[model samples]
Structures are given as C-alpha cells and as structure tokens.
Target chain A: MTHTEAGRYLRLVVAEEAPRTGDTPDSGARRVWEIAFGLAARRRFETDSPLAEIGRTVTAAVRSAALPLLEAEMLVREALGEQVPVDGIAESVRTAVHLLVFARLADELALTDDELDSLIAQAEELAAAGISPRSEPTGVP
Target chain B: MGQTGTLYTAAGRLLLDALGEKSPARSLSHCAGSPGAVRLLRELFTVAVRRGFVGRDPRDITAYVRDLLDYQSLPAGGEFARQAEAVMRSVLGEPEVAYAVSDRRRFELICLMVGDLVRPPGVPTGELVALMRQAERRAARS
Candidate 1:
C-alpha cells in the first residue's frame, strides 16, 4: 500500500507480465505512469476544471527525482489521450510508474495480502528517506 | 503461477508474435474484419480453452487481455468500440439483450477476442504449455 511497496509490485509484475525483451514489447513503467497520472487527473478534475492543480502535482513529480519533467508532462498528456510525440522518455516514465501506480493496481487486480507485501522489504530499502513518488509536490509549488 | 497458467502465457506470447507476422496490418482490429481471420482466431481460442489456458485462472486471463489491448492499440472507447462489441456477441454468444452492456464489458470482450487470435495449429497443447512454463521460470531468475 505504501509507495515503496507499490514500486516493488510494479517492478515484479512488469518483469513477469511485461518482460522487456519480447514480441509484444512494452515499457511497464510507462503503463504505471499512465495509471497514476490517470488516477490523479480523475480525482482532482472530475467535476470542476483543476488543470492548474493537476499541472502542479505533475510539475512537482517531474521536479523531484521521482520522475523527469517532460516525461511526466507527456504522460499526463497521453493519459488525457493526446497524440503528442513522447520520444526518449519511456525509461523515465516507467520508473515514475513504478513509484506511483503499484498500490492502486493491487486493488484493481485483487492481489492477495501476502502478494501485496511481496516486495515491501526490498522497496523500503530504496526509499530510506521516506519520500515516495506520490504527486504531492515535495518542495515545489 | 500454476504450470497451466504459465504455459498459456508463453503460448499466448508466441501466438501474438505470429499474428504480428501474418496479419497485413499487424493488429487484431484488421484481423477481426476478415472472415478468414475470424476462422483462424476461433481455432486458436479453441485450442487454448481445450488446453485449460483460460477459464481456470482469472489473473492469467486478465494479464492476457491487458497485453492484447495494449499491443493492438485498441482503446476502450474509440473508433473500434462497436467492432469489439460485435466480436464479443458473436464469439461469446451473449444473448442479443446482452449487447447493450457498458463500455467496460465491451472492452473486456475485445481483449478476449484479441488474446484468442494467437492460435498455432498442430502443436501439442501440453507440450506448448510445458515449454512456456520452463521458459518463464528461467526468465524470472534472470
């Protein structure tokens, strides 16, 4: 349920289900990014126009080491279904997705409690500073 | 994952690769429209279901569906939405009344249809599944 836990789950599932070298090639991280950005967009802007609020969260995620700025922006654009060119951001996007969407997908996939905890210990090691990739704007406005 | 599920995953991957090679457009959307393509897809699904690839594991089915949708680039709500619906009704044999379901169900059916397109003839079902499981186990460690 935590960010690190989410990251690990994303890593495992992507590795298992979306292996890098395959015919149906994919970037698991990109898929993760789409889910997170998509969820955040839906929550904040479902009723009124909150593009600024969404943009700020996105800008901050990009500003942080959690995700690259342009990649995060393009992901937001893609989640909105824009057909923009997002070349060279796949790796960065995947890392961000690893940080953001794991917990959310756990619920959607009905993962078991044990499965949810599968990589928590390893994930905790990655975020010793306690900062996660949730779009909460760590130090930027 | 069970041996059966793992095997199906592997077979599914091979079928997906084969589809890309054989199809004119390298997409299920194109294949769905052609009568010849539909027959080929039906055969693939028959082989998979008979071998217990799907229907046994929801997770397996879910993963397969996601991959198919992504690979085929078929949006849940897009130009091909109606095509997906038709495929579901014909393939799953849902009652005519069930045709008016939500977009989400239609999307799920489309994913199912796409996943079923990876049909390889003459290969022993048990052998294919076993081979995929072995490959999966090795891949997990690497």
Candidate 2:
C-alpha cells in the first residue's frame, strides 16, 4: 500500500483503538505541548505549534495510567533505539496498544475538564515531590 | 526465515499440546526448568497483560509480525541485508530479535518456542496446552 494508504490505515486503526483505550480527548495547551515535544523528540514535525502545552496534557494522561504509561514508555524507547519503521507492523502493534488504552479510558471515563485538570495538577505536585518511578511494577530488568 | 522443524519434533509437539488453550500453561518455567518454556510463558503473560483481544484479524497480526522481521536481522545477501538494516533502524524492538520473525514466521517461532518449552516435561505439556487453549478461547469469547 502507498504511504498515504498505510498512513490512513494507521490513523483508522488508531481511531478504533483510541476508543478501546478510552483516553480523554483534550485540546488543552498542555496536551498540544506534549504531543508537539514528543513529535520533536522523534524528529517529527506537527502543525500544532504549542508542543509544550501538549506535552503537559499528555503528562497528566500518562500519570493517570501509571503502569501502562511506563510499559508504553519503555516500549517506545526500545522502538526508537531499534528504529522501527514509522508504518511498519511492529510500530502499529505497539502504538495501537498505547493509543487504545489511553484513548479508550479517556473516552470511556469521560473525566470532566476540571477533574482532568486536577489530576494533572496532582501529578505535577507528585513530580515536584520527586515521585520517581511512580508505581513501578516489580520485574527483572 | 529458516523454519525450524523443531515443532514437529517430540519435544516441540509436546510443548504445543501443553501450552494449548485448554490448560493455559502456568509459568511453565517455574517447574519445567527450561529457558524455552520460561520465555514462552513470559511471552504469553506479556501478550495477555498488554494486548486486550489477540486481534481477531490474524492476517493483520501476521503482517505485523512480518513487518517486525524486517527489523531484527537479515539474510546474508546484499539486497536483503540492506533492507533488514533499514527496518532495524526504524521499527524493531529488543524482544523482536529473540522472536525475530514475520507472519508465518511468527507461527513457526512461537511453535518452536512452545515446542521446546513443553517437550522435556511431557505430562505437563498436555496439562499446559489445555490451559492455554482455555485462556485463548476465553479471550476470544470476551
């Protein structure tokens, strides 16, 4: 399939998966920043200008899923190191897993804007307090 | 992909039967004392805990695995090695190598791993396969 076809397929897969993950959708500055920074880290460019805000929004979302977030973080770190193709099957597998979980939860739980804001706020406080490895699951590294 | 006919071997068959859905093999590594079994069980656990539905579309999964093969390693040919290298740099993960595989390749690898794990301990193989089958069926039903 062409990149456009593959890319569209991926977006659709992610869309279906987003509902599975139930991630609360947000357009907050923080969310924008988080996605932006993430894209930049991967040497990706996005139309969204305020990456920092997107980053913060995603941070709150990450803090909430704690365990899954870490699982995903490690996977991506591993993927980047491996240089998995952008639209390859493995990338799809990993990305779908994360997107599904977060998106489903975000959509299903439907946390109020204030509730989400507070969660992020709490997460920020925890960060300030140096809550390292928040809820780290025990396992051999 | 070198199809290790290991699954057809006595040990491999024992493992496939053992780790089947009926019994849903419990950390076979615990008593089996086999690295292969340990790895198999580990894969099962990771796959279970992480992926919700094993993806009803097996073809999609096969494609995903095939895409993965492009990442881990390549055949010792100029045309092939270059492509493999490109994939490795872009998409594959650490575990991808150990399971370094593609579509039908994944089935072969999983079969080999499971076969190896359940072979030594024959009795447990039967028991475990039953368990795995059950779990898989349940997952499918859910």
Candidate 3:
C-alpha cells in the first residue's frame, strides 16, 4: 500500500520475531545478506541460479567485504535469524552491502576463475571484451 | 507422507512469512536510512509471496533486476524506476488491480504478479529434473 503503512506492518512483525543473537556476527551478517542477495538476484540478473552455490560464493564476497564496515554485525545477529523485517536496521545494513558489491560484481557469470587469476590481463582488457561492466549508459536519454 | 517435510526445514517459508508479515512505515524525511529506503519495497515483495504472486523460479531478485534492465536497454538503476513509472501510468489508465488487494500490500502484490515478466534465466537442462527423479525413488524406497 502506502510507504508508511508497510513500515507500520513491518514493525509489528519484527516485534514478534526473536531478536538477533549476540554471538557470531559473521553468521548473522551472512544470513541477512543472503536475503538481500536473493532479492538482488531475482531482480537483477533474472536468474534463479544465483540461489545456488555460486550465489553463495558471490554472497560470501559481499558479506566478508562488508563485515568490517558494520558496527552492530553481532548485535544484529538475532534479528538476522528471522527473515530480515523490512523495518529492521539489519535490513539496511544487508542491502547497503549488496549494493556496494553488486555494483562491482554485477556481471558475475561472465567472470571465470581463470580470468581472476590474471588480474593484469583482465584489467587491461576490461573494456575490450567479456562484459566487465557497462561503460556506456542505456535507457535514459 | 514424504511430502510433509518438503518445505519444512527450509528457510523459504520463513522468508515468505517475512515478506508477508509487515509493510514499512512512511515518512517525509529525506533519509529513513538504508533499510528504510528499501523497506517499502521489501514489504511489497512479502505481500507478493503471500499471494503466490511470485514464481518458484530460483533466481534471486537482484540478479533478475540486473538482467531485465540489461535486456530492456534501460539503465540498471532505471529498471525499478521504469517499472514503478509504468505501473503508475497503467493504474492511471485502468485502475482495476488496486481494488483487488489491500492498500498496504499493493506494492508487494505488484512485484509478486509481475516480477516474473523480467524474464527467467536458462535452466541447466535436465540436470535438476533427473536429480529429482532419483530423489523421489529414494524417498519411495522406505
């Protein structure tokens, strides 16, 4: 419905769920990111394959990269244990992490292990080839 | 008998419930924070799940957004914007779908109903179907 109504509903749901665990921030971050990653995967690349091990691999990158940037990663663990309520602080943290990493790793399927091994080669040919990133814009004129 | 535990241990139902449970609050402030920014959007999705509006296809939503944007020749960021814009225009023209759902669930309902139009990815051929068949046989054994 309206933006505020949804927020109200979210608070109620979050209230019912157990708060996040205090221990193991790493797992907590990992779990919440998993949902954001799922949303991004569904909406971004249009592929469900992102739900598999490869998705997990990509998630591992986003989560580990973001853990250092977050302060409440541990306090938020229990909140993360539930599906991240739309209103929870963990939801924002998780999505912010996904946005940062997804911007870099967007065309993930195009990246191969072999290419990653040789950074200089890939970096040099970044624009020359296999969809590194969108240099030229589209849709908006 | 074997079907009882199918989605039982899985987080899918939990995720689905979260999607269904709450709608985000609205505010005029410029920043409700990061989760705040997407809170409304996530509620829309949860409603979608509750209504069975979303497809069972496993692609995560972000990746779907990326691919759909790329395909539409729209800037990736513009993808959701475009959809939101289009839906607005459609409602202005027709206005029927809104009546079918509660106001709080509208956005999520849209995502559920139309999110699949973003186009699904190629399947890994018969790989999964074969696996399912084998698993079914195993389940039948006991």
Candidate 4:
C-alpha cells in the first residue's frame, strides 16, 4: 500500500465506516491499522488527564462499542506512550482496536471535519516520508 | 482433598507473601527463578481462574486484569498484558494461547493473577487456602 492508497483508505474508513467494494481485503486491512495507529500517535488528550483517566475513557468507549476489553487495554497503553506488541496480538483484536481507537480519539479531540481531514493528510505525508513502511504499516510514530 | 506436602506449603507461602506485600508484582520477580514455585503458581492460577471466572464471559478476565493493573498503578498494555490475558484464557480451555507467552513472563503473570485472587477485602484466606489445596491435589494427580 502506497502512501496515497493509505490516505484514501483512511478517508474511506473514517467517512464511510468501512472500506469500499473494490479495495483488496489485505491492503484495506493494513491501511486500517496504519491509519489508526498514525492517528493515535497524533492524538492529544487533555493536559490534565491522568493515565488512569485516559484508561477509563478508552475502556468505556471500547466497551460501549462492544469490542474486546483486551483491545481497549492495549489502546490505552499505546496512547500512554507504551510500545504495544501489535504483531503478537490477534488480527481480529488489532482490527477492532484500530477502528474503535480511531473513532474514540477523534471523538475525544472533537476534531472538525476539516481538522480530521488535515490529520489524515499529515498521516499521508508521514507515511510517504517513510515514518511507516508502505508494505508493512508499523504505525506513524 | 489432602494437600500435596511441600507443593502445598510452597503455594500457600507464595500466596500469603503476595497478599502481605505492598508490591506483589515486584516481589514476585524474586521468586521467578524458583522452578518449583513457578509450577505451583501456574497450577494455582489455573485453579483460580477456573473457580473464579468459569461460566462468565471470557472478557471478565480482561476487565479484571485491567482493574488489577489500575490498582497497582502498572501500565496496562504491551507484551505483559497480552501474555497475561493468554495465560488466563488458557486455563479457561483455550490452551493454545499459552504458547505465545514466554516462560519467565508467564510465571510472573501467574503469580500476579493467582495472588490477585485474594486481594485485601477480597477472597477470604480460609477459602483461598482450600482452593490452593484443591490445586495441589490436581497437580499431584497429573
């Protein structure tokens, strides 16, 4: 997946809530994780928000979405500057965290549509610059 | 069931030490080198999960671990969380997940979770001891 393709899928997922029909499942899935992790790297919680508070927010959002709780824990840890072993986690769990975490961070930050678009654009630039690999998305950080 | 001699003693000692320690996770590291203690801890962990969490959704284990980490002020994700969840689920009949966790970390996680079964104002000591005794029997038989 090229950087442009990564950006396109990020828009598709965030805007349409799923990938479009023509997108290959493999590339689409990879983009989903890449975009999610990239956005997480850019997310900024409230300055006063403690780690426990961030954990609660992430956990509540994940539980409400009916995603796996372990996924929520992983997301919280990642948001707190921990290097989570995404490769070792189950794909289904990773995908769920990807989708839910992207949405939750967006909600938490209350980004306007234009701002969200800009974030995606920045991610695309970062991806193109090799912040993350095209063949394997390791996240934007 | 009768206790299995030294295994029972060692298991009970570990549990008590964990319960009494201000920093159980840190203290557990000191005992991680003891193969016998590690084996007993795994058996006790399986018994604790089976007794405490069976018949509930597997997600409860995740929630419990989250709460445990929160109370201990430990970071909640990474390889430790993944391996910890896998080890707990392994006892709940999904044995394959256990293979992904390393031996040392697995032993430490077992100690953490098994010790968690009797946190303050949590499970009564007598009941926990009985549960440990049951695990001892299961280990002896196997």
Candidate 5:
C-alpha cells in the first residue's frame, strides 16, 4: 500500500455515504489526536493496561471541560517521568490514530471483509515506512 | 427517571420531533436559527447525556456538533472539539455509569454548560419556555 492508499480508501467509503451527512472534515485529524493520546496513556501507564482502563482515563480528561490534551500529557509525563518523547510519540500517534479511526469508520460504512483487509494492509505499510499519516493531505478543501 | 421526569419525557418527544426526517446537519441548522431550538439541542446533548439520558448516542451527537459548527460558521475540528467528541463517544459507549451532575431544578442547566463551551450564551428564556409548552401540547395531542 502506498502512503495515499488508506486515504483513498476513506474517500471511496465516503463516496458511498451521502456527502452532506458524511463525517466531518476534521474527523480524520481528530482521530489522530485521540490515537496519540490513547497510546501515550498506555505507554506512560501500564503496558498491559486494558483498553477500557485507558479509555476511562481518557474519557475523564475529556469531560473535565478543562484543557484535556494538557491534562492527558500531564498525566502521561507524571507517570512516565520526564524522559518521555512527546514529539516522537505524537509522530507515531498520527498513523496509529488513522488506523484506529478508519477501521471503525469502515465497519460503520459497511465495507466488506476484503475491503477492510486491504485498508489495514495499506495502514500497515504506512506505519512500517515511519510515515506519519498526518503527512497526507486530508483533502478537506 | 430523575426529578424532572415530566420535563425529560416532554423534551424527549420534542427532540425526536425536531430530528424527524432531517439529517443532523439540517436539524442543527434549524436550531441555529432559533434560540429555543439551540437551547434544547444544547441541553439534550450536554446536560442530558450527563444526567442519564439513556437514549443518548455519541455518533448522533457528533453529527449534531458537526452541524452546529457548520451552522455557526465556526471551525469544526479543534483540540477542544475533538476532545469533546471523544468524551461524548466514550460516555455513550460505556454501560451503567454514574452521571457527572444532577440538577433537575435548574432547567437551564444545559444552557449554562453549552454557554460556557460556546460563546454568546443563548438565553431566550421566553422562547425556550414557549417551545417547551408547544412540545408539551403536541405531546398531549399525540
């Protein structure tokens, strides 16, 4: 899968859904942020922490109505100490987030099993190349 | 089943009606034009979700937010917006969780929450009350 494959897949899926009722322009980017935060939470806390546990922590931060990202970063840094790679984690988080968000969206859009497999393969290729999914233009314009 | 059982029941019908046969964006655009609709939409998603509106669905609310932003001509994706979306999605996905706040007496509870989140708080108290009355009447008729 080339760097643009996952995005292409998303566009194809979006084409099937109604344009006006489709996902937001920033859904892809938002998913990136969510993924990064989730990964940092897991790494900063227990490596084996259940997804639900990390999800709870993330949810609490978001509901604080305060600075949620700051709160999440603070929590992760406090747990992982000062040496955590904030930039590196964020870089890797972009791809991870895209993978997670698209996988769910695919299901919601009723993409076939074969289509899902192809999308995952493309994502894996992007991740393996160390190419941040954020580098891809979201075509929002 | 909180203290405002009657109000919630009435409000639920109103919400369903407001959303009837319209995409979330279209519905929100209609709300954007009316302060009463704005108050109801805001409260139903923010306050009601926190106060045990079991019917709350995050995907639906996300679409609501997306449309509301479009209605206001505000940018859709920001850190806070994304985080808020995640919060709604997480809360709705969870099962048997406790509410964050409970205030049946304050009918304007949603107005306050949404006002703080968005600017130029939409009061229109008279309008919202009228809308509620209309909803109650329609509910009665049905």
Candidate 6:
C-alpha cells in the first residue's frame, strides 16, 4: 500500500472518529498496526516519570481492556522500549496490543488534542516520506 | 562452592535486611548500583523460587505477586508484575521469558521476589539458607 494510504488508514484507526471504508480488511489491519508501531516508536515516557511506573499504568490500562496477561505484558514491554519478540505472536493479538498500548500511552502522557494531532501528522509525514515505523529509533536502550 | 558461599552469605544478609524493613521490596533498591550484588540477588532469587514454589501452579505465583504488590500498595499489573512473574517462571523452567526484562528492572524484581520469599512468618532464615546451598550444589553438579 502507498504510504499516503497507510497514513490515512492510521489516522482513521487512531482517531476512530469516523468510519473507515475502501481498504480491504487485511490492508486496513496492517495499516492500523503500522500506525500503532509508529506511535510507540515515539518516546512518550521520557519525563521525570520512571519507566517502570509508566509501564504499570500502561499495563493496568491494557489489562482492564480484557487483553490476556501475557499479551498485556508484551505490550507494556514494547511501549517501555523493549525489543519484545513479536514475530511468533499472532497478527490479531499483535494488532490489539499495538492499538491498546498506543492509546494507553497517549492517555498516560495526557497529550493535548493538538499534540495528538501533531503526532498523527508527524506519523503521516513519515509514512508519506516512506519511513517504516520499525526503522524509527526508540528512546530506550 | 566458594563463590556460592559468598553469594549465600550475601543473600542471607539481604534477605534479613529486607525482612526487617517495613518496605521490603523498596529497600532492595540500594543493591541496584552494584552489578555483583544484583547478580548474587538474582541467583538467590532463583534458588528461593525454586525451593519455595517448584511444582506449584504457575498461577499461584501470579496470585502471590498480586498479593505482594497489593500489600505494598503498588500497582499489580505493569512491568513490575510482569517481571516478577517472568523471573519466577524463568527459575521454574521457562527461562526465555526472563530475557524480555531489562537488567535494572530484573534486578529490582529479583530483590522484590527474594524479599517476598522471606516476608514475616514465612521461611525461617536457616532453612532458607540451607535450601540455597542445596540448590547451588545441585546446579553446580549439573
């Protein structure tokens, strides 16, 4: 899929304010995952807050959504800058984690609407520029 | 056995200190600066979990972590909870999950679990020390 198309789909998934139609389910799912991955790549916990504490908040949020314990742990680790092995995980599970974690992270940071829009815009710009979310450098070592 | 002896002694001291502290898990943070101390603590943690929890339901470990965190008023479902479960499970024969945890956090978790193993009215100090030595010997032979 073209980066522009992917970005549009991502914006739809992140905002979820409008119905998304047109892209096939497969392609739509992939784009949403990409957007979640892109958002996660951005450092959302670099403030005075401890990573562990942030991880707890994110984990609690994800678990409350009824995601299984292991999957919730994986999402928390990924959000906290750990390179969790996702290759073996199911696409559907990975997608859920990505979406939930991305949303929880936004909530945790208390991002203003403008800031959220800016981040989505940045993600769109990167997508349009052909940047892969996986290639983005994360803050955690 | 010599290295194990030193580790055993250090583990015993740390456990005692943790048991005495009102906030046992938080008290473990002091050893976070010393990699050597952390390593000893990790080994001690492995021994403690193996001795105290082997053959028990893995879910019990999860419940135990939840209770431990709840007692301390800490959040029970984040990195700390995950790491605590992973660390215990690793020692329980699922070692790979432990790799997902970072060293600093892993050390912190090892301290927390090790401290939990000795929380008041839990394992007696001498019995716990004996278990550590026996486990170390078995591990060395293998």
Q: Score the docking of each candidate (DockQ).
A: 0.02, 0.02, 0.04, 0.09, 0.04, 0.03
Q: What order do you get sorting by TM-score, best first? A: 4, 6, 5, 2, 1, 3
Ranking by lDDT: 4, 6, 1, 5, 2, 3
Off by over 4 Å in 5: A1-90, A96-141, B1-46, B50-53, B87-142
Q: Could you tell me the TM-score of candidate 1? A: 0.25
Q: Which regions of candidate 3 are displaced past 4 Å?
A: A1-48, A52-54, A67-119, A127-141, B1-48, B53-55, B58-142
RMSD of 5: 17.0
Best model per lDDT: 4
lDDT of 2 by residue, A41-101 (tens): 2332122213233333334445454433323433332222322223322433344344433
DockQ of 4: 0.09
Worst 10 residues of 4 chain B by lDDT: B1-10
Candidate 5 TM-score versus the reference: 0.28
Candidate 6 on A1-141: residue-level lDDT in tens?
233454455455556553635534464445545555546535664322343465465556566656544555555445444544233455666666666666666666777766766676666666556655553324332
What is candidate 6's lDDT per residue for B88-137, written digit by digit as tens? Answer: 78788766557767877777777677667666786876777676565455
Candidate 3 per-residue lDDT, tens place, B39-113, comes to 433433334333331343222232344454455554544324224322332333223212323443445324433
Interface RMSDs of the predictions, in order, are: 15.8, 14.7, 13.1, 9.8, 9.9, 11.8
lDDT of each residue in B23-75, candidate 1, tens digit only: 52335444444444344444444344435442332223323434455666655
Worst 10-residue lDDT window for candidate 1 chain A reads A132-141
Quote the true-contact fraction of every model: 0.00, 0.00, 0.06, 0.12, 0.00, 0.00
lDDT of 2 at B94: 26
Candidate 4: list runs displaced more than 4 Å: A1-141, B1-11
- Give me candidate 6's TM-score against the actual structure: 0.47
lDDT tens digits by residue: candidate 4, A1-141:
333555566555556465436533474445545555545534655322344455555665566656655445545555444444333566656655665667677777777877777776766666455565222323221
Give Cα-based local distance difference scores for all models.
0.42, 0.34, 0.33, 0.61, 0.40, 0.60
